[model samples]
Target: MKKYLLLLLIGSSFLTACAQDQFQRTSKGTMYKNFTNNTGDRIKVGDIVTINAIQKTDKDSILYSSYKGAPIKVQVQAEGDMMDVLPLLTLKDSAMIKVPTDSLFKDPHAQRPAFFPKGSSLIILLHVEKIQSLQEAMAEREADAAKKQADEVTLVDKYVADHKLTVITTASGLKYKVVQAGIKPKPIAGDSVYVNYVGHTLEGKIFDTSYEQVAKSAGLQQIGREYEPLKFVLGQQGIIPGWQEGILLLNEGSKATLIIPSKLAYGDKAAGPDIPPYSTLVFDIELVKVVRSKAAAPAAATKKPAAKRTTKKKTTTKKTTVATKKQQ
Candidate 1:
């Protein structure tokens, strides 16, 4: 009985090896193996194909998978690349394609990406979800976008109503209300401003705050992170568009609640794990201080070419703080 079991295991391993060796190569040298043989129409050039894709390295480490999000929609082309294999697939078909890294980075002058080392093959597992005309795909996408925009507006409205808040809506769709009005002399572009703010989603879930106590209360405290007033130049592109626009309405010592739409916030892209795509952000902000800009001074008779100023945008939503110093 033991001898028979060993023979069965060996036979299964051999069959698996033979199956893996059945991959066929395309004219461009892309190797692919189809798991399904559907009799439906094959994908063609100019056809918009929706597919669920899983990208991995030859070591079987997953790089990305559409299962976690929406499937991708792409129009097929005559390009001799890995996408060339799409033409051989039909709707509802499943397949695997392997592309060499050397072919992907064929430019000898360019340095290859560190993740994709030389002689490594990028593997792709694909499932064709749908095939449609370009017109149909565009119409569908537009409808989806319209629905999402309406949904976001409904969510923001409900949150405001539930909190019993009155907001002043702006022409650009920003809704804000001055809780404590400040004196005149509001900050303008090119001015340095300091602020303490608490940012949350429409659901009232706090994602970030400049106050250390707030972070502790929300269980968001990070070790070695100093929670203090955030300092940045007003009109700098480092912050979101909503924050930039809403801050302009407040003067030093003013406190306001800004309810920003997703379009003015992160839009369709998710910011980290806490802020999801199409999220409507609510910020309680206090304008601590504002320093006037030197550029706003009256131009001198011999104006040296105004030096171009460039600021690097912060990639993350978390605010950075500077060490507190005695104000001169």
Candidate 2:
């Protein structure tokens, strides 16, 4: 009786291993295995599907994981791609997909990723989280954006009140407070202005500055960088809207604080590792000089080429906090 039971246990273990190795091939020749076959509604074309996914090589080395951050939301496509397999998965379903490296690098001219070598397969482990219709997805996105914008406004307002700042609110929602008044000549559109500025997040973490001491204090000092006032033409498309509008209210030698909302800055996109998406920025700005455009400049200055903007050296600094798109 003991021998018969031992043989039966061995047989069951063998069958289980064989079943685990079996994978189904799709019409497009992709190999897949479903671990949990749920009866819930399966994904469909145009459906926004949220899933937690882990991408790895055949060797089981993980390349990327949505679990570390946020689950991925993808709009299902008709056919012709790995995403086509999404239609087979229902909510809460878990599956494994194997894609041949050769198929991924089909173009002979294309270079294959070093991790996924020739003859290897890229594996994807997926867990379906949620599924929504196209209309539902759009509505949810809008609702989320509105909530985020409202929350940002609340934070900004609180920051202003906590700091006991008396600010002038602009029509576009920017807030500024003059610390010290300067001369009578304020800058206008098309004027080349040189300004020294220090920028930080709402939490008071400095991200960028034109002053060497400020950068050193914030631990953001870049080697071989020449810390100097940033120069840019007012009303230019390259600079952030907040700086363009706020700087117009200040004159040479004037010092002020500008509290910029994300919409006036980077908006939904993160500036760099330091500045997250939807961040509210604060800047201490000092207008050093202003040179009017030729149209606005005195006649004698018009003969000279509009003072060409030049850089002292090639700085390795990443332009995360500068007003200009490429760092003013």
Candidate 3:
């Protein structure tokens, strides 16, 4: 009877050790599943699909997922970007796949632990909810884009209507021109425009101006403090929207005085001590010449996309900021 009791104790010990060993190994398996692939589309190597998936890592972490009530659209072509299930695309929708650790995305951008210097493995559990074709995908994208544009236009129109500020043209149909009777010199929509201008606060403190453009043009100086009339592809966010909108209404050699309200101009932001917050700005603008495109402007020329309303700012501000090194 003592020997029998000893045998029972040993058996219990062995069983407990095996249970612990099973618990330590982090493998992929599903806790729950409720998805179906009804579309029977023959998935090719380049097919993109909307999948609702969840991923877990060896650190006993559930790292990534697309199972947030909405199906995530994923391109199979971008499979190499992230891994875990790329090497094996065996299971389709409604199937819970246990992914091994060797198939995770190898990233050059991840931090040290995420990208182990010694390298690590990841396990994944996936659920694909739906699939779509390339054309169908493109149509969905276009529909979303159209909806966004419509929404933006509606909001902008409502704001303009409430503020009574939708009149964007002068009597001569020029938006940016010298403020004078019957002399609406303005820039046109499709014309390449050049301009000299000055910016100042409503209190009339000068901040920036193209006044030195004349001295530089006259060859009396190697460089000037002000920028010359520059060229850009109009309507391309190459310049401030105010300048673009204003310039689009002016013809060649037209001039204008643009009085920009705080909101339309740089609102609630200190451009410098020169421009205070909530300042209604003003500019004496001129449209120097309207031509075809000046040239393909470099990335530096139109680097920053504009962030303000353009009553028309002629964007011909192309004065080279970099100076050539002169021999000492």
RMSD to true structure for each model, in Å: 18.1, 18.2, 23.1
Assess every candidate by TM-score: 0.73, 0.82, 0.37
Q: Which candidate is the best by lDDT?
A: 1
- Full candidate order by lDDT, most accurate first: 1, 2, 3
Query: What digit string (tens of lDDT, one per residue) describes model 3 on residues 1-328?
Result: 4533443343334334433544222123321221244444544445566665555443435566554445677766623322323223333543233333333334545454543233454433455545566777889877865665465445444544664543454443222334532244444455566677777654556677666754444443444244577666577765655676666655566666665544455655657767655455567777776677455666753334434433433687544344344333
| Tens-digit lDDT track of model 2 for 1-328 | 4533443343334335534677787777778877679998888888999987777776656688776678899888876545768888899887777788888898999988888788988777778889999999999988988888899999999999899999999998899999999985998988899999999988788999999998998899999999999999998788999999999999778999999999999998899988887888999999999997888454562233334444444575443332223322
Off by over 4 Å in 1: 1-21, 55-64, 99-123, 295-328
Better candidate by TM-score, 1 or 2: 2
Off by over 4 Å in 2: 1-20, 296-328
Model 1 is weakest, by summed lDDT over 10 consecutive residues, at 3-12
For the record, the alpha-carbon RMSD of candidate 2 to the native fold, in angstroms, is 18.2
Assess each prediction's global lDDT (C-alpha) against the native: 0.83, 0.83, 0.51
lDDT of 1 by residue, 1-328 (tens): 4533443343334335634686788888778877788998898899999998777776656688776678898889888554789999999987777788888889999888777899987877778999998999999988988898899988988998999999899899999999998896899998989999999988789999999999999999999999988999987788998989999989888999999999999998889988887889999999998998887567666635444444445896655544443333
True lDDT of residue 28, candidate 2 = 76
- The TM-score leader among the candidates is 2
